[model samples]
Each structure stands twice: as C-alpha cells, then as structure tokens.
Target: EKEVNSMIGRNPDFARRVAIDFSDNLASAKMLIPIPDDFPIMAGEILRVNTGLDIHLDANRRPVVALVGVSLMGVPIPNAWLGNMK
Candidate 1:
C-alpha cells in the first residue's frame, strides 16, 4: 500500500483518482480487465487493489482514521500495472 500512500499523500486531488468506496471482499478476487487486442492477456489475471482505514495520530495528537489504498479501476486499457513496474 506504500504506492497508494505516495499517490495520495493526504492530497485531495490525488486521493480522488482512487475509488475508496470499493469493498474489501472484491480486492482479492481475480478479474479480467480487457485491454487492446494487440497485447496478449492470459486468463485469470490478478490485480492488487485495496482499501483500508489507516488509524493513527497526527502531529496535533488527535486520532485520525484515514481511508487509504490503491484503487486501480478495471477497464479497457493499453496495459495493466504491476507492483514491480516503475
């Protein structure tokens, strides 16, 4: 989830790019994300999308529950992102 934190970093605009409402139950399930025909896609592909409550104390010493996780939406695209990719 470090990648997610880097993208969001408590920024509103960055956070909006990810879908936080998604259920945790759906995160682990393998889903097919159709992409361009030129690229060959093997069946039963998996993407690591997630959602969670990051509960911790801020600089002000107040409890904060921040929603954090990667929400890479599944859809037709040129390529799928892998964790090792830069």
Candidate 2:
C-alpha cells in the first residue's frame, strides 16, 4: 500500500488522469473506459483497453494479499505519427 501511495505521489498526472477502482471480488468491480467521439477506434484498441488485475498472495501462516489493476481509458498513439514522416 505504501508503494502504491508513493507511486501516486510521484506521478500526480497519472493518478489524476486515470480512472481507478478497487473491489473485494472481480465480479463486483466495474471499470469505465472513455474514448472521445472525435477519436478513431482502431481494431486493436479494445484489446488494449481490457487490462488484467494482478493479485499477489503470501504463503505464510497468516496470508497477505494485494491486488493491482490498471486500465487505460483511451487508445495510445506513438509520440510521432509514423505516416507524418516523408
């Protein structure tokens, strides 16, 4: 938890711009990905938006667990458009 908080503090822009949620079970969790109407949705965009949640568990007498989920709300493009170059 401390590591996650520290990461959020270090990257304020990422923390503010992304939509994040947490739940006890996968069935109960809901994620909303927003794509602008003006933006084009390519074939692979849906696959990119659908990310997985990682669950880490400890095997000690008293188990400890952590769940991390990241969802990208928009299609990501390269910093420079490939077609733009002559």
Candidate 3:
C-alpha cells in the first residue's frame, strides 16, 4: 500500500478514489471505495480471479463440480473462496 500512497501524493486533487468490481455476462457486483486516485494505474490496470473448480455436497450428500473464474476486463484477479452455511 505504501507504493500506492506515494503515488497518491503526486496528485492530491484531481484524483478522487479507486474501486473494484465483479461481473458476469448476466450480472455485475460493484464496490465503490474511497482511495487516493492519484495512485498511478499500474502497468496492468485490470484484475481477475480464477475459481477453477468448486465441490459441494447437496442436501442428498452428493458432490458437484463447476467451472468458475472471475475477471475484470477478462483478466483474472486473486480472491479467496467463501463458504456458505445455514
């Protein structure tokens, strides 16, 4: 974060904030964040995530697998898998 902070110092006014979002062909989830927009957009200004395979047990105790991945402009970003529980 230090690197970004340094960049932010360069532009103290024009830049406003940074944001990250997740989207699929059919839907999108967006999170707007307040950040030093002065931070230079890195060489690769895109982010993406890969969710290779998912395994889960259904109510009947059967395992299921699904092909999954995430992308910001088709590039993969890093992410952690979250489990769903009732």
In terms of lDDT, the best-performing candidate is: 1
lDDT of each: 0.44, 0.41, 0.42
Per-residue lDDT tens digits for candidate 1, residues 1-86, read 55545555588764544443334322222222445555566335434344445566779999765443334454323223433331
Worst 10-residue lDDT window for candidate 1 reads 24-33
> Per-residue CA lDDT of candidate 3, range 1-86, in tens?
35544565476552233322233322222322333546566333433332344446768988765535444545555445332321
Error of 1 at 1 (Å): 19
Candidate 3 residue runs with Cα over 4 Å from true position: 1-51, 70-86
lDDT of 1: 0.44
For model 2, residues 2-83, the per-residue Cα lDDT tens digits are 5555665577665553333444433112333345556666432322342334343456655443323333444433424424
**Candidate order by TM-score, highest to lowest?**
2, 3, 1
